[model samples]
Target: METNTQTDQVTNYVYIHVPFCLRKCSYCSFFSVNFSQEASSRFVKYLIKEINLFKQKYNIKPKTIYFGGGTPSLLTAAQINLIISQFDIAETEEITLECNPVNITNEFAKELTLTQINRISLGAQSFLDKELKVLGRLHKADEIRNAYKLLRAYRYNNISLDLIYGLPNQTKEDVEFSLDEIIKLEPEHISTYCLSLEKDVPLFSKIDQIPADEKVAEFYYLIRNKLISAEFEHYEISNFAKSGFESNHNLCYWNDKYYLGFGPSASGYLDFNSKTVCHPERSRRRDHLIRYNNSVNFEIYHKMLDEKKIMIDKIILNNDDHEKEYIFLGLRKAAGLNLEEFENKFKTDFTKKYDKVLHKFNNLLEINERTIKLKSEAYFISNEIFSEFM
Candidate 1:
């Protein structure tokens, strides 16, 4: 909320969404369509147009670029290059592409390296075949192993393995068994997420079959301790990484920095203050914090962009909304919030602003004059603590 013009200028991260999949996962709620060469080609063209529109509007020079999916690996190397070529990316920008195991091959990896993509996030949900089937994953446990070896053989050192826990009938031992493989594999980063049976997803039909909340909390601690013991830093709620391997793109989000997201179902945020001041010496006439989303309907998106309609829903955040998001997102990081930074940004005394809530949850949150963080034991109940800020 206290994000001034200078903060906006420094937060130019980019996210490109490719929403096509061969099959849908039972737990997913993201907008995506079935793959077709003709449809994908058409979508790519529209995507380029959308990217250009943002580039023109914001004049952004990106610090990091994230290619997220419906399996970004499905696109040919040539297609990848075509999209990236349009961007004014830094030479050392962290270009990340999320991939599926079955889509990775040694030949494909070589071609992919040519695109200058430095980070590859392999979707290795679980090592147990039974659990994989429960989540409706396309590849088997063996394919995860094959994909890692293939990428390594091609010299892709900065790889991140994504894992899921708290599935139906999952246990602490099962989580430990999977971590054995993850630890042995020794990825530069590890992202472990708890399964959510979102409404309307196929898995929601059997929500009763999933583990209890208590069980899921146990699984959370199990994996947290595993990564810590293996010497991986728990940098975020669901992310662990070796030193210097934390995701720069994702860090932008938790730190409440401005980022531009392109493609259908993608969301973006921007903040600035107009220089038209009533008093010549004073800062800003007014601060504008805008968040926008493109149309999720693929057909509608294409028609709008092609005709220059650009069906984007834009919302201007009020002071309350911005301040709430600032605290909420900042608390998710492992190093936690700096008291001085928070106070300086918002032009407020941090402890004084949320005195009641901080006092109420004092046992769960560790607060000092300099910083504030959730205690390790209270991480599972973070939502409840964050709600007080709301």
Candidate 2:
């Protein structure tokens, strides 16, 4: 891991987590509690405290701010504005708020325009109400349409719609219907996720109902081709966007840049001079790069902040860890990983170090003079390919 010795530089990206939802989705595994006015108000106060604590530690001039959540839309426009006021944001900066369709009322959209928020990511998981019911979403199919119209009426040009594929008993026509609606709406960006039945999620009980692996792959390719044909760039594994509208905040993550995360369960990565030793067995030498996660328990989070103590699990990254992360994270982008840049960063020849794994997955990967990437057709099995590096 390279040491960033400069202490004057500002961390330009920030992620604020709002961990309260009206209802937890059946497939969600993220940390969130049922929404309550009193609890949410209290959470906001503590969230501001957490932000202030970090402000004292780093010089943060945010270029991109992302409010992700249990449902960020649940926050009042004033609450959202209070959070944004903490940063020195420019008009050109991209500030995105993820919203549940049901929460985007006309009045809410009007108030949002008064804030610094420039982008909206609407959670429209499916165009069919039946699928939404199956996934335990609070809104109906019509609400998604109404929400988009409402946002547009308030002059929100940068909007991203989310879609989920490979639902139980989902068919080709089902996907086509959803795709047709999405294309017609012409959102500035689109994110598509394939349903994964994690054991901890309520949806896991119906694991057998999921489509076969082969069918899921077909759905993936179908989505890719449709979005591409609609003039959207397939920029990342699960994201597509119109040119110049690709998510700058998400791009920061994929490009391996430093970012700050605030609120409970939020995680952050930074490169700085520190005396912390990650591997005491190897040497007592300081590690410069570290990733830390705030406590998931809300009570502990508030208590630590109240006591002016940082409650985080921190991991110092060594060269090997950094190299693996760079490969996996960089490969998630459609542009792939640049071999020259990798060698420059790690002081290792890419071809020489992983020659065996490279040859093993030769046909699935695209290797050129300067870059290496998975072929588009092989994206469905990217996890299997990434495991070789692990």
Best by TM-score: 2
Per-model TM-score versus the true fold: 0.93, 0.95
lDDT of 1 by residue, 1-390 (tens): 111222225446988889988899889887888988888788789989977765544557888899897778888898899988888776437999999998898889889979978899999999999988988889999999999999998888899999998887788888888889999999999999888867889988878877889999998998999889999999888899999999999999998888888888888887633232113533442336778788788877888787654325777776678878888888988778888988877789989889999999989888888989988887888889899999
Instruction: Show the lowest summed lDDT stretch of 10 residues, model 1.
Output: 1-10
Highest lDDT: give the candidate number: 2
- Give per-residue lDDT, candidate 1, residue 71: 74
* lDDT tens digits, residue span 235-291, model 2: 999999999999999999999999989988999988743323234444543345789
Off by over 4 Å in 2: 1-6, 274-287
Q: Residue 204 deviation, candidate 2, in Å?
A: 1.0
- Clashing pairs counted in every model: 0, 0
